[model samples]
Target: MADPKGFMTTPRQEWPRRPVEERVRDWHEVYVPGALLPIVSKQADRCMDCGIPFCHHACPLGNLIPEWNDLVSREDWRAASDRLHATNNFPEFTGRLCPAPCEAGCVLAINQPAVTIKNVECAIADRAWEEGFTSPRPPERLSGRTVAVIGSGPTGLAAAQQLTRAGHTVAVYERDDRLGGLMRYGIPAFKMEKHHLERRLEQMRAEGTKFRPSTAVGQDIGAAELRSRYDAVVVATGATAWRELPVPGRELAGVHQAMEYLPQANRVCEGDLEVSPLSAAGKHVVIVGGGDTGADCLGTAVREGAASVTQLDIYAQPGTERDEDAEPWPTYPKLYRLSAAHEEARDLGTAPAADADARLFAASTLRFGGDAEGRVRRLHLVEVDAGRRPVPGSERTLPADLVLLALGFSGPDRSDGLVDQLGLELEPRGTLARDAGFATNVPGVFAAGDAARGQSLIVWAIAEGRAVAAAVDRYLTGRSRLPAPISPYDRPMTV
Candidate 1:
């Protein structure tokens, strides 16, 4: 252990964000750069290095958390990076995007605040990139087999990198003009700058992972032709079928899916447009949903200079601390947490006047009202009870020029005809069905990530990608040395 009594003395410290007033003016990441360097070690030292390390059980990747925590406490960043990369293919992405269930599972959290595991992980990854510890590791010899991975999200990228290092010729097929899928356009720059995604793509390309952008597997290129050219196929196309809000004013011009609104802002950020077509600027925005996507919308809307922003959730506000009775230690608990976006929005006072935090929990949407031009002008909502029934005489109306549905996705998008063209059977949940080996019903075809597992965290996507690569490697060579992070049926520790 780095320090036997470290956990007893040090308090949990996390990476600090840039001040709200400053961050709201630009699209840069929320964190104050270089702020974590001094405190990260103390935070890492808080890891008790539990004998069993419940953090491992909580993480889908099964990362060696304690070992890396010890390394960080010792200020051995180089070794920490090495230890981190041993399991995770993209710690940089996970460090920023993941909710860090590992921290929730920390044995220290049973009593005191948990170690700042996510912050430490991010520090190690950033250090590795700066110190040149990360380099292209191309295979010394080719296995003579070829693989075609559909999609360019975290899962596809991870699988492609693993298969490439295993000596197979791999090509990633993406429908978008650029690589990285959601990492490219779905995520905003303020959360994670696009440069980070670009730099990693460069490394993957240098390592012999061929990328084919602007090619839709079932549309631009037929699935039959794709399968014929590749020895094995891995579909990592993420779940893009967004959930809908079907109520009055559904056909209104300003009522949009979160996917529709966020991507437009991202495109403007990418220089595709001077301003988003659905820019939230000078408008009152109401976001429906309280998950990460809704928070992302909240942040994006604020940055766009919206007049006001309000987020509505069906569930009541979560507790600040984990309730051991409802959710005991070791299981990832659902607790009230303030994200970087929420902090900024709160500071701006764009939240509803009465509900200053901008969140209206236990709320129900009755319908919507539109102006003469059919543009969304207001939202009709009511307070809800524990049973989700409307409370009596608690109805209210809010002026809203824009209504964004940040409701989560349903399953992988099939509009492009990839599943139909490939004749792949989908589970009842609308995701592609796969066997324990990550193989689909068709021979020489497999699936992974959100495509197979439904919508999930980026960490899970990368983990499943790594696991599916091993299954594919063995299928081709009859045996493989690649690591399988988790079995197909192994869900995350979260309920």
Candidate 2:
């Protein structure tokens, strides 16, 4: 161990976010550049390197956390990066986007705060890039097998890279005009700039992974044709269908799904649109759903100069700390978190706002009220009981010029014609059904990521991609040497 008493002597210190006022004014990431490096070593020293190291099990990628922690604590960033990258294809993406369940399983977290594993990871990745430790690892030989990977999201991208290194000629097909799937379009640049994604894509291209953006398999090329053209086909299309609020006034103008609103803002950032079609500027915005997607809407509304913002959650607010009885140690705790968006909302005097932000807990929407122009102007809501049923005589009207249904996605968009064309079987949950090896009923076709697993973390998506790639490799070559992080049937503890 780097320091025997490090956990006790050095208290946990996390990376400091940029000042709220300064960060919210622009689309840059919230962190102060290079600010976490000095403290990361100390935090890394706090890792107990437990006898069992449950952190590994906690991560979907099964990242070698303790090993990298020891390396970082000893100031061996190169080795730390190597260990970090051994499992995860993109630590930079996960370090920024993933809600670190690994920390929950930290041995130190049984009593004290967990080591800042995520922060250390981000530090190691950033340092690697700065020091030129990260580079393209082109395969030594070509396998002469061609593989078609559908979707350019984390999973597909990871699989393509892994397969490319396995000497397979991999072609990543993205439906979107640009690559990176949700990373490039769904997520706001404020959380993560597109440049990070572009750089990685450049690296992948250099490593012999070919990208075919704006080319959807079912649309541009027939699914059967794609399967026939390639030795193996891996479908990594993510869940794109937004869950709807089917209450009365659903047809009212100004009521939009969070995805509908979020992507426009992201497109505006890409300079594709002069102005977003559904901007919240000068309007009172009500975000329904209290998950990360809802928080994202809240942040976007704030930046777009919304007159007011209110976020509502049907469920009661989570406890600030872990519930020991309900959620034991070594398991991810259900706790309240102030995300970057929530923090921004608070800074803007919204409900999470210390002085102004508006959040309504245990609230349920009743209906929408529109003006003569058929434009929504108000929302009918009520305080709900623990069952989420409205309490009698608790109905009230709140001004809501724009209402975003931040309720999460249900499954992949079946309307895309891809599923129908492929005649893919779906599970009861409406996700594509895959067997133990992430293969669909069709011999040469396989599915992975959110499309197959439903809405999940980026880390899991990438893991699925890498694992599915191994399955595809095995099918193509009769036996594979690629590492499979997890099986299609393997459900993580966090999930």
Candidate 3:
């Protein structure tokens, strides 16, 4: 253990966020710069480094949580980074974007706040870059084999990096003009800056990984042609076919999907455009889903100077504390949590909703009322019970000039005809069908990440990528040595 009594004595202290007023003005990340390193070591010391270490079991990547926590506590930055990289291909991305289910599995969380594992991880990753600890590890000799990855998201990137280091010529194809997939456009800059992604792409290029942006496999190049060129093919295309809300006035001019709205805002930040055509300025915005994407929309709208913002949740509000009978310890619970976006909305009075956090739990959208020009002008809703049945005498309407449906995605988009060209089978849940070994029915073709699994966290995507790379490497060579973090059938703990 780093410290014998550290868990008992040290209280968890997370990285501090910048003042709402200062951060909302620009697109920089919310955390205060250079503030984590000073306090992270102490926070890391709180790890009990338990014999069983449920945190490790909880993480999809099987990250060496206790080991790295001890290393960070000892101030051995190099060793910590090395240990962190052993299982995870990109700690920087996960440290920022992952929900950190591992923390929920922390032993300390049974009684007290969990150790600041996420903050410690971010600090170590940032320090690794600053101290010149990270570098490209190109293969010493080529295997004379080539592989093609179909997406440029985290899953595709991780698989490509692994295959390249194993001496295979790997090429990643992305339909977007730039790489990084959702991290490039779906995610906003206020959550994570683009420079972090750019530097990592630079490192991947240094390692001899080839990238083909703006090249859609089924559209630009035939899938059969791609299969003939490469020895093996891995599909890591993410689930981006967004779900739509089928309600009255759905075709109104001001109603949009969250994906459509977010990407345009991100383009403006990328300097592709001076202003987003769908800017939320001077509009009363209503978001229909209450997941992380909805919170993202809330934050983006707040920054864009929306006149008012409100989020609707189909489920009732959860309790502040975990319910032991329903969700025991070491399992992620559905507790009421205040995200940074909700905090900004609450403080700025931008939501105008009765709820302090700008969210209406148990709220269901009935329909939208539009103006003569067919622009959405108001939203009609009703409160619901546990069974989702409407409660009596609880109907209301709110002004809404702009309505964003933040409902999540269903499965991988097939507009480019990738699935049809390859004749890939899909599961009942709308994901690409794959065997336990991450192999598709077609020989020499594999599927992983959200394409095989459903929409999931970034940590799970990286794990799936690593696992699929191992499967692909084994297929190419009679015998191989590559770490597979999780089995294709392995799933996360859910309540």
Which whole-number lDDT from 0 to 100 does residue 79 have in model 2? 97
Write one digit per residue (lDDT tens) for candidate 3, span 308-413. 9999999999999989989988888889998889999999988776475889999999999999988999999999999999999999999999999999999999
Candidate 2 — which residues are off by over 4 angstroms? 351-357
lDDT minimum window of 10 residues, candidate 2: 350-359
lDDT, candidate 3, equals: 0.92
Candidate 2 colliding pairs: 346-353, 349-356, 349-357, 350-356, 350-357, 350-358, 351-357, 351-358, 351-359
Clashing pairs in model 3, backbone N/Cα/C closer than 3 A = none
Q: What Cα-based lDDT does every candidate model obtain? A: 0.91, 0.88, 0.92
Candidate 1 C-alpha RMSD relative to the actual structure: 1.0
- Point out where model 3 deviates above 4 Å: none
| Candidate of highest lDDT | 3
- lDDT-superior candidate, 1 or 2: 1
Quote the lDDT for 48 in model 2. Answer: 89
Backbone clashes for every candidate come to 0, 9, 0
Q: After superposition, how far is residue 383 of candidate 3 from its true place, in Å?
A: 0.6
Error of 1 at 168 (Å): 0.4
